[model samples]
Every structure is written in C-alpha cells, then in structure tokens.
Target: MIEKAEGTFESVMRAVRGVTRAVAAQVDDLVQRPDVLVVEFGVELSAQAGAVVTAAGASAQLKISLTWNK
Candidate 1:
C-alpha cells in the first residue's frame, strides 16, 4: 500500500513539473520576441487514481498578439 501511494505521488509531481517547465518555456519565448505585445496561456490538468485504476491527462492553450509601435 505504501508503494502504491508513493507511485501516485511521484506521478502527480512529474505532471506538475512538466506543466511548470512548459509555462517557463512559453515565458522565455515571449521575452525573447521583441514584437510580442500581449500573451495569454491556459492550462488544465486531470488525474484519477484508486485501488483499481489510475489515469492522467493535461492540455494547454496559448495566445499572442503583436502590434507595430509606429
């Protein structure tokens, strides 16, 4: 039982880490691009674990807008 609980915790941590990395990358990209005027991102995650089954899923959406200064 302890091993199963540990595995579930590890799985959840990995998913959270992945999401953090993805958001960091997006921020880096926006910072490096001089033409970016506005940016937005949406992230969602779902997980299920139980004695009989385990599942996980994630999704993300990004939007960027740019305009000329002159």
Candidate 2:
C-alpha cells in the first residue's frame, strides 16, 4: 500500500499522466448492523495508453465499513 503522501501522489499521477480514462462507479448495496454499516460499490475504469504511455491499465473497486460506539 502507498503509505506516504509523496508516494500516494506519485501513484495517482502515474495512472493519469499518460492514459485516457473513462471512469464510472455505483453503490451496488449496503449492509447495516446495530453498531456498524458497510457499503460496497462497483466501479469501472477503462484505460487506454496515450502517445506518452508505454503500457498502462487501471481499475479500482472497493468497499467501506463505518462504525461508531454507542
């Protein structure tokens, strides 16, 4: 995982610097419990290398959980 700010910035730039991207995302579903909530999303990222890119492909999909002490 990219832990530092500089590394994170570079990671993002590397994906975008030389590629064309069509990005889409949707929240597909969620689960709720007494103490927490979780949500999952579907994401589609279509990437094609531009003239400056040698080879590149990228997509991101993730789920998040939120919780609070009662």
Candidate 3:
C-alpha cells in the first residue's frame, strides 16, 4: 500500500513539474515577443464543502486577449 501511494504521488509531482515547465516556456516566449499581452491571476476561494472545483482549480492563467493593428 505504501509503495502504491508513493508511486501515485511521484506521478502527480512529475505531471505538475511538466506543466510548470511548459507554462514557463510559453511565458518566456511571450516576454521575448514585442506585441504580446499576458494577463494572469488566481482565484480566491472563500469556503468549500467536500469538493468545490473550478476551472484550472484556482490557478495562475495566462490570457492573450489583444488584436494587432494591421
């Protein structure tokens, strides 16, 4: 049982690390670009019962919502 739980935790951590790397890379790319607008924020949860889930689950999301003048 302990071994199975450890394996699961390791897998989850690996996934989280991968996601963090991808996000960092994307943000770096946007930073290098001149005409890139990035908006990021986190959700503030007041109270929760059992499982109150939201989109991305209170994460830091980057949104590029801008149009270039052609």
lDDT of each: 0.59, 0.42, 0.47
Error at 22, model 2, angstroms: 19
Off by over 4 Å in 1: 32-70
Whichever of 2 and 3 has more TM-score, that candidate is: 3
RMSD each, Å: 6.3, 10.9, 8.6
TM-score for each predicted model, relative to the true structure:
0.46, 0.27, 0.45
- Give lDDT tens digits, candidate 2, residues 1-70: 2244345456656655333221212222323333554545443433354422223344555455556576
TM-score ranking, high to low: 1, 3, 2
Candidate 2: lDDT of 28?
A: 22
| Model 3, C-alpha of 19: deviation from truth (Å) | 0.2
Q: Which candidate number would show the highest TM-score if scored against the true structure?
A: 1
Q: Is candidate 1 or candidate 3 better by lDDT?
A: 1
Question: Where does candidate 2 stray beyond 4 Å?
Answer: 1-54
TM-score of 1: 0.46
Root-mean-square deviation of candidate 3: 8.6
Please provide, for model 3 over 26-57, each residue's C-alpha lDDT reduced to its tens digit, 9 standing for 90 to 100: 76676344354444433232224543232113
Instruction: Estimate, for each residue in 1-70, the C-alpha lDDT of model 1 and write its tens digit.
Output: 5565567667656766776677557666863544445655565545656432235455767666665554
Clashing pairs in 1: none
